[model samples]
Target: MTITSSPWVHPEPSQSQLHLDVVPENVLHALAAGESASFVPRFVSPYLAGPECLSLWRMRSGQIVDTPTDAPWITRLMVDPRVTAPVGVAGFHGAPDDTGMVEVGYRVDPLLRRRGYARRSLETLLAVAQGHPDVRTVRASISPENTASRALVSSYGFVETGEQWDEEDGLEIIFEVSAG
Candidate 1:
């Protein structure tokens, strides 16, 4: 139950319900092929299986630059380490940008929601963000209509900074919390 030591990747500490494993594109490939690995996803996550996740995988696969193995930061699978059953996907939109801002996103499986899994998973991710020296702020964009999401982040000290209209997500209330 040891976590990886990569700076950009974090495996959740034992206290968390699900292990937050930083999933690289290559690992995603293995999962997609039904191949085995220590972190291979055991449960099918609609968010992970959707086109958005596939597009992220494809994008990461193409950006084979000098970025650290964990720099992509596009996806992670939350799994029960004992049984290796994936509960959801959570990750940053990308690594911290020039402004030292990184967007966080998470989706817990419908069957697993309301059980505190999302909170634990997000807490783990937030720690990772705060640990990174480059991260000044961790951002979350929740649709005004999504009360659950707003509550989840607000509990973590995130405050509404503003709003934005996204083509796919429509109007979203942008929130942020200092990474420190």
Candidate 2:
């Protein structure tokens, strides 16, 4: 099903509490000061202080980094409903490429996994991508050993396309979900 027409795309008033705040280019500095450049820190997760986040922020578009909320794709903190702590991080690699393909990625805190946050966040991300006319496909690259991840995306209509090798991630199985 297309994200736009998916029931999970739109969260109910209560479940809509999760917010996606774009991580700025200097996210490390922002997080150090308890913020995300443009917004105050809603929650703090250990991932925010890791090199992974720094790397992701560095790859962000300068223009989008300046005006984070407007970024087509960037790492974001997934604030819990209580609004006092971060549940996880979620985002895309960037805007759609020339081939209209965009990569979707996310990671929920280990303690918070299996509670449906990843699925919800993914649905929301898909909706955001579907909103853009240029995004025709959403790709997810999962490690061969990550059965949970492979199963997760597959449940949402993502089909295995092929595989590729990465220096860091090793062998990865590529999955693609086409826009409807």
TM-score to native of every candidate shown? 0.75, 0.75
What does candidate 2's lDDT look like per residue over 44-131, in tens digits? 5555554545554444544364664435365566765664556777777766778989888888777678987787788778777777
Q: What is the C-alpha RMSD of each candidate to the true structure, in Å?
A: 4.7, 5.3
User: How many clashes show up per model?
Assistant: 0, 0
78, model 1: CA deviation in Å? 0.7
Candidate 2 displacement at residue 170 in angstroms = 1.4
| Candidate 1 segments whose C-alpha is farther than 4 A from its true place | 1-14, 27-47, 50-72, 82-84
User: What are the lDDT figures for the candidates, one per model?
Assistant: 0.70, 0.68
Candidate 1 global lDDT: 0.70
